[model samples]
Target: MYQEITHSFTSKKSLLRTIQNDNIVYYWFSLLFLNKSLRATLSQNKNTALSYKEFIASLYFRFILVFFLALFASAMLFHVFSDIYWAVLLPVIALYLSAQKKGFKAFCNIFEEFINQNFDSDSLQKKTLYQIGEFYGDRYAIHSLVDTLQRNIKTYTYFFGISFVFLVFIYPINTLVTCLGLLTTVLIIRIYFNTFSLLRHLQNNK
Candidate 1:
């Protein structure tokens, strides 16, 4: 969920709020206003004709912004007990890796679905996907969006998994919190796999 930017130059309070609120305006506005060439290209490519370099740059920018914020918050919260702030970055690094991996898979799945539709008749699921594509401008945009989502979900699983291990190493006295983190990590992993399973089911149906 991203809040739209209202000004070319936003105040510090607004910037911090935007980050805390998960508002993309934090970095999106920077790309739109700071880089004239990229802005012009993006304006011309309104139909989601973003270049590969642009896509990677945008993803990294957003990821880096969130990573620092998470790192700061984790440090503040954990400073009372331990000084293992570096451990917070493990999940962030894993998130970048997983995003690239899952994002490619999602793009392939989406492309396969499009190809399947061409050779075979339109099924209910394919039609629904096409309709969903309308909101995303096209399949390319959908690929970007799906990739973002998959990476976020995977990162959450990574976060909980890391949290469980870190807590055990630093503050093993809190068994309840550690167990909850473990359960959350497992649950999210299951859901992540289910997303791919659903994609496969849709493709097979067609």
Candidate 2:
């Protein structure tokens, strides 16, 4: 009886560890591939006949579709391999990362083209200065930006709130993880913007 109980406990622990590891891997892989796909599709379709906003929306939907498909594939692969899932996934991920680098460069070119077409040098410079000021200590600019951000946030908040409530019913653990993930993402974005603002300020002063 003692040996049976100990064996069962050990097996459960191992299964739990495997699931945790798989979840972590899936999260990162999905994030990276989705982001790259977004950039790639946008850049590739930038000069297509579609209008800018339409093109963006289409690409956004496509990326979301691809993300779910890839996720399903990964889950299937994980189940099939049982023990060496990462080994199979690593090569595919590497190839994806390499392709994404080229796509990212293309995306950067599209951005440059857009800026060149839409924004004159002085206007662009002033916009940069304003962003820097807001980042540093300009209360007025900060307030203005915050108002704009808040409006956008409200839209996402509704969607996320609904999703969280649903997840709570189906998977409470996922709901908690999702909340923490969102918080971390927000913090990282805040830090990145602040750092970019400081760098711009330094460049202007020099």
Candidate 3:
């Protein structure tokens, strides 16, 4: 009887885990669909009100800022100062590691060298900025790291948090936190899907 009870308990636990994973899959599906839709909506105009280039650029900047703000808010709410400090560490480490990347750093150094040379060009964008952008692009590699970090953070933020909420029904404040956290995750997932759908369309066209 004890063994049977243990078996049943394990089975129930497995079911809950499956449900949680299903929730995550649904979230990704939402992201994929939404991204595609945005692509279509923006590209619909034969002569768009805004240039396509500007549209893309605007989306990029806006999403980046939104991501930054979300990160900021999470850290602030949790009082996780060290967590936010990753922003600083990322850049410094990227710069130091950049030195080993086969002259990429040297190419980038032209920017600093130019500033040191004190050229009489009135415009700052004269030339060094281009080299800087190129070298610095890979310096921190935030873009490359995002997929992994996002996977971990999203799971922790959504699935684990939800699980904890269900388990913590005894706590009063959990009701509020759980609701807010779940709602935020849902919204973010929806936005991600909208853009993802657009990306799919672009890929299909190519």
Candidate 4:
């Protein structure tokens, strides 16, 4: 019975989710500026092109890599501190999730209302608008999640750097130093690819 319960518990938890969650930490540590700016822009742009459902739904994910890269470079140059790290991290993710859910709910409500008011599929504008609304709802949630990840990536990188650096003073730090060098080579390639992907996506959109 105990063995069955244990297996059940483990089976309930997804390894993919665990990996993605781990990745979120890395992304948060890497992308602070993009997180802040993009979230803010979304708020300020109540009537922007991105507000359109189809446009956002189709392109919500195109900017996350850019945001991540922005965060990474910002961290390398600005140097993220350990102070208030936990306080900052949890609230950001929570707030983003709440905001995203609320926005999507509102969009869905509006779309439904419009459809009820004019059950006219023949009108391309009405049909497109409703479709756009549905798309926007999807894209909004995705964009919001990406923003949360972007912020978390920076936070993760900062924390990781601090933890790794701290180990240097406490023990035979030579090993860490060597490891960091090797990791740097790997990170260089990863970062380069990330940048290229962002540029390519952006250019494609343009």
lDDT of each: 0.42, 0.40, 0.40, 0.39
What lDDT does model 2 reach?
0.40
Per-residue C-alpha lDDT of model 3 across residues 1-206, encoded as one tens digit per residue = 11211222122224233323443332332232224443363345444323443434433443554455557657777787756566754654454334223222221232233233433333333433223223323442322222433573565567646655664664546567867756766655544543343345446544
What's the residue-level lDDT of 96 in candidate 1? 56
RMSD of each: 15.3, 19.4, 23.3, 14.7
Clash counts for all predictions: 0, 0, 13, 18
Query: Considering summed lDDT, which 10 consecutive residues are worst modelled in model 1?
Result: 23-32
Q: Which prediction has more favorable TM-score, 1 or 2?
A: 2
**What's model 3's overall lDDT?**
0.40
**Predicted model with the maximum lDDT:** 1
Query: Local error of candidate 3 at 203, Å?
Result: 6.2
Candidate 2 root-mean-square deviation in Å: 19.4
Clashes of 3: 13
Best candidate according to TM-score: 2
Model 4 weakest 10-residue run by lDDT: 3-12
TM-scores of the candidates in the order shown: 0.26, 0.34, 0.30, 0.26
Across 1-206, the per-residue lDDT of candidate 2 in tens digits comes to: 11211222123224234323432221221222234333354335646223334323333443443354466567876685545555655665555444434433333344445445545555544443224224422422223333334543564566556655655665577656878856755543432222332233324433
Q: For model 2, what is the error of residue 35's alpha carbon versus the real structure, in angstroms, after optimal superposition?
A: 20
Model 4, 1-206: lDDT tens per residue?
11211211121123223323443322221222123334354335444323434223322332443344446556656666435444455655455445444433433333334333434333423333223323433543333334444454565466556555665554435786757754764454344323343334444434
Q: The CA-based lDDT of model 1 is what? A: 0.42
lDDT order of candidates, top first:
1, 3, 2, 4
